[model samples]
Target chain A: GAGVSQTPSNKVTEKGKYVELRCDPISGHTALYWYRQSLGQGPEFLIYFQGTGAADDSGLPNDRFFAVRPEGSVSTLKIQRTERGDSAVYLCASSRTSGIPDTQYFGPGTRLTVL
Target chain B: DQQVKQNSPSLSVQEGRISILNCDYTNSMFDYFLWYKKYPAEGPTFLISISSIKDKNEDGRFTVFLNKSAKHLSLHIVPSQPGDSAVYFCAASAQGSGTYKYIFGTGTRLKVLA
Candidate 1:
């Protein structure tokens, strides 16, 4: 498919364990973003990477949540010591650029369930 | 604090009727606003957007109106179709931010009943 793709459409893990979710953006996209959507809420920004560097990560709930886009094409979100609170739909988005009129294309989220 | 808010959790309208979804923001710096539609288990798709400089933008059957003075915006769909039923989200961004980081509203689920 030409749109963003995310691996492991769904994941189940026990609390305190670690998990990794991957995202593959559309070809040539330079900006990638990670967001979490809980029941009855909108997706909240977690981190954003411009190329291989994280341009902003102020939305990360805590230090345990980390993400990286080493090559700027594929990105991974790593969660350590997951809690039930971490259960939500993890969404990934990509855009051609991060400047004005920025429009993001999103991927079908990976539903993370931390029991 | 939630910079953007969608007070209505859900709305139901009959097909061929008009549907209106409203949004409000508390941030004064937001210069651009956008609307997104999401289906179950799928990612949100960009619907339309309007800049603060414009009071209204229209595309096909959809129209978005922005009231910068009131910090409010609305999405209107004429002759709503059942396929248009989904969750709608409102997002905003400031101008100077290089990444144009978006702050999103909780979302309002709209059901276009056939």
Candidate 2:
């Protein structure tokens, strides 16, 4: 089966611009998550969606970051007025359900560079 | 503050040798621990996991050991092969406490020489 997939593997934009990263989870996955990874650091949680609704958004660094999963399969991570600090590899993952011991399958990730 | 820490940035081992990676956490609330392997330009893939209730979990050549009292865990691979070389990340979640988001460590790069 196909694993998770992300589009626009690399994106470069100017500071204060807007960018959107897309994620396509495996078929039938009910839970999706977004994370950001900076250089020399591990991935930091961004947001999570259960079905079409976001179950958790506490990991969003600020109001500038937002994510949505309209139909429950594909998710988009949007960044408003991006800053140089926001440059990093954006990762997306999904699992059958947001239950304990559930394994998440990850996508190749989209690397965003805010110039 | 980093809730999960992988002190070693890199490790090297010969083929068929044992490779051990360690992780420590500052949060006592974390009950579910997981290990992930990542190749360059790719997102992390799940490798193994252990629950706080169990001291150890083994699968094939990979084993994960958890020490709740010490807030630590370790992943050991026997007969390491070149294919095993990659960055390994340890993640923790307080699933029992209702939080499903994971806190991941910086990651340790492993090089298996054949």
Candidate 3:
């Protein structure tokens, strides 16, 4: 309800296809983040958003991955030319501010499977 | 390169006993550390956090300790319960700015037997 919400809890796509995963942050959260988690591993940062702008995207594996937060509240992660290695649980988290570095609330995550 | 590491992959404790999870890092610029707990198919929830300046921080049943000198940290749960059975992750923030990426450890699954 009030927590971060991710759409398309699961996504299955063929290799080299395109996919988009959506994330709806909490009502007032201004900072949103995207992370990818592989099996038995910790989440790795993919992108960070402060409002409508991406503050850092160094964690993005390649040019195939891109994200946008148009209204600053809801964001979408778009993947192009998806590969099997891209399959993982994509997590979205939101916090009060990127500077706060305090608490972060996460969504259930969208499981992406590539064939 | 993995900056944060949780040497132990899993830990088990009897209910009502104390449970301790350990974590270490290779970075010295990290200013803040936090712990999160995750259950099956669910996102991780924030448990506790401690600043590098402070040696400890406590909240209810959870406590976090930071040792900046040793680049080590720990999460302690007193009177552990079955509900505490989950994967615990340790994370760190480096000055918390710009991208504000918080690197995380592999995670340790803590099983509290009832």
lDDT of 1 by residue, B1-114 (tens): 999999999999999999999999998889889999999999999999998889999999999999998999999999899999999999998855564678899999999999
Query: lDDT, candidate 1, residue A6?
Result: 97
| Residue pairs in clash, model 1 | none
Q: Which stretches of candidate 3 lie over 4 Å from their true place?
A: B96-99
Worst 10 residues of 2 chain B by lDDT: B93-102
Cα lDDT tens digits for candidate 2, B37-112:
9999999999998988899999999999998888889999998999999999999998888777889999999999
Better of 1 and 2 by DockQ: 2
lDDT of 1 at B90: 98
Instruction: For each candidate, report what fraction of the true interface contacts it reproduces.
Output: 0.73, 0.71, 0.71
- Per-model clash counts, in order, read 0, 0, 0
DockQ of 1: 0.78
lDDT of 1 by residue, A1-115 (tens): 8999999999999999999999999899899999999999999999998999999999999999999999889999999999999999999999998877778889999999999
Error of 3 at A40 (Å): 0.9
Model 3: lDDT of residue A104: 74
Q: Model 3, A29: alpha-carbon shift in Å? A: 0.9
